[model samples]
Target: MNESIKTPSVTDEASTPQMKTKCEHHAECMKVIQAILDDQATEAEKDHFRENIDKCIPCIESYNLEKCIKTSLADKIAKKPCPKNILNTIISKINS
Candidate 1:
């Protein structure tokens, strides 16, 4: 028998406050969002992101919007491979 491991989705994690620290400003929230999306955020940064999402309605909405867009694009790209011509064209442009 095979067992599957379950991981929390971004929405799941964002739905609750994992830490008590409340973010003070929108700019700070945006920075945390960028870090999280870039996968360059430390654990503390991630904690701040989560805390802000829980404490700030604007942050929660922004996180949800970004997450939805990212997930949607990833799903679409996974289902459709880029055409070789377009890929080569992009490579050529980069090399130009």
Candidate 2:
């Protein structure tokens, strides 16, 4: 006889807070995810959000999308300072 291994199913309510529901609306979950990535969420909050995100596919995808946006913005903000000589040359070329 062949036996199948049983795996657990993840429901949003299983990981979400008592006040929150894993229903059709996801704006609240997305807010939690944003706070998580921003590091504004406390450890407990982070854990709660992470747990919920781990279970909710839509929330997980939204988190990943937001994370990428954060990464891209950070990259832009951390761009290397322009060299003075390069800037001067560009200005000169522009004026020519």
Candidate 3:
């Protein structure tokens, strides 16, 4: 079996073509990203993002940042149960 993969040295990386730092469609990408994350994206939108994400680093980073924020909020926020007294009062008022 093959062992560990070899990472390029700093010098080797420096000599290669620079990775793209900007994406022209970043704004549009963000909108599509929101739709996708919110489960509102059409199948075509999902396919488009999947096709472009590998080449567009800016969009990829934005997607990751948005995902992290959503995940953190979901995991950290506490859910509290309503007090029984309040629940009883609301039910009594509705019945009357």
Per-model TM-score, in order, reads 0.52, 0.53, 0.63
As for candidate 1, its clashing pairs are none
lDDT of 2 by residue, 1-96 (tens): 546865545775476645333536588777787788888887877877757765576776788899999999988886689999999999999999
lDDT of 3 by residue, 1-96 (tens): 556877799998878866457988888999999998888999999999998887778988999999999889989999899999999999999999
Residue 55 CA displacement from its true place in model 1, Å = 1.2
Clashing pairs in 2: none
lDDT of 1 by residue, 1-96 (tens): 446866789998988666434445878777788779878899999977765666677787777888788888888875668899999999999999
Count of backbone collisions in candidate 1: 0
- Candidate 2 similarity to native, TM-score: 0.53
Candidate 1 TM-score, true structure as reference: 0.52
**Candidate ordering by lDDT (highest first):** 3, 1, 2
Clashing pairs in 3: none
Higher-scoring candidate on TM-score, 2 or 3? 3
